[model samples]
Target: MKPHRYEEFRDLHRAGAPLLLPNAWDHASAAALATAGFRAVGTTSLGVAAAAGLPDGTGATRAETVRLARGLSRLDALVSVDIEGGFSECPEEVAALAAELADAGIVGVNIEDGRPDGTLRDLSHQCEILRAVRESVAGGLFVNARTDTYWLPGAGQAPETGERLDAYRRAGADGVFVPGLRDLRIISELTSGLTDTPLNTLHAPEGPSVPELAEAGVRRVSCGSLLFRAALGAAVAAARSLSVSADIPSYAETQALAGAFA
Candidate 1:
């Protein structure tokens, strides 16, 4: 990665407008996004796992995550990876994975506190993992600490959200991500409470727009699994459209898209 890429990615969060980050699954998706003028891209753990026929958010795709990171290093756009729960319960192991991703030219990573069994990880242990990852990357990687307070069923309330985020910030997280959080009022409160630490939230199609999110003080808006899921839907639609004919990219065009990175 370019020495300034990390700083460049960081600056996006501080810009006047909120950063609209799209997540990609593989080289073609990432390269296509970059070619279409997206400055930064992130990998969706669901996309990575599903593409490899594995389960997502269950520590089944660590090797696939790392391998995809290495391949994404070739893309022109800045890249961040979603490492679901860091694939381990050990802080040291999670830190080592972060380090390896940094070495692979990943500018950032999203390590969530959500676990495989539909529950959140212990706050103290999650903080330790964040601290270890932060120290491992030496500030070279943007560690976006993700909390599942809003994602997991009956996890906690709004007050707990602020508390967890506060602990993560103190643990050296560069940013805090809250997926499934859509209330503008609560989002504003969280951003206000966070102060300088960027607040990232997943974009919901039925929720707020980018401008609405920006106005609510969200520094980063992630597409999460939306794009991957949309792609799957599109593929099915295209197959069904065979009779009516669809305007899908030709084989050569698809090859050229992948070849851009090559």
Candidate 2:
């Protein structure tokens, strides 16, 4: 990645309006999003894993994630990869993976604290991994520390969520992410608590709009796995009736979109 690319990606969070980030599953989806004018693109681990017949959040897609990141480096838009639990328990291994992605031209990464067996990692160990990754990137990558407190069963209370986010920020996370959190009051409270650090939340169709989220102090909104799932739904619908009336892209257009990267 270029020296200034990190700053460019970071600036999007502080640009007044919240950044509406769409997660892409592969090269074609990412390229299409870039063509549609999204400045930054993120990868959804669920999409990546499912596309490869692997399970999500099980630390089983490290090779596939790295390969996709390398391929996405060819795009003009900035890319952030989701490396679930950094794919290892050792801090050094996670840091090595972050450095490798940075060398591959990825400007950012989202490392979550959620484990594969439906539990969160130990707080201290999670912070250690964050610190190691921060040191490895040397400010050249935006490390968005993700805590799946609300995402897991029996959604963690706000107190624990705030505590974890604070520890992550102190551990050198450039930004913080909490998926499956939809309460506006709690979102406002968390944002107010972490005044300096940017807060990212997942966008839900039934939830507040982008402007509402920005008003609540969210700096970034991620469309995690929504686009990929919607694509699948559209494909099935078209196959079922052959008259879905969706604006499907032409074969030549898709070919051109994919060929541009070549």
Residue-level lDDT of model 1, residues 207-253, one tens digit each, is 98888888889999999999999989877887887542465566887
Model 2 clash pairs are none
lDDT for 7 in candidate 2 is 92
TM-score per prediction, in order, is 0.96, 0.97
Write model 2 residue lDDT over 11-93, tens digit each, in one string: 99962598899999999999999988998999999999999999999999999999999999989999999998999999999
Clash counts for the predictions, in order: 0, 0
RMSD of each: 1.5, 1.1
Could you tell me the lDDT of residue 177 within candidate 1? 97
lDDT of each: 0.91, 0.93
lDDT over C-alpha atoms for residue 43 of model 2: 98
Q: Which stretches of candidate 1 lie over 4 Å from their true place?
A: 243-247
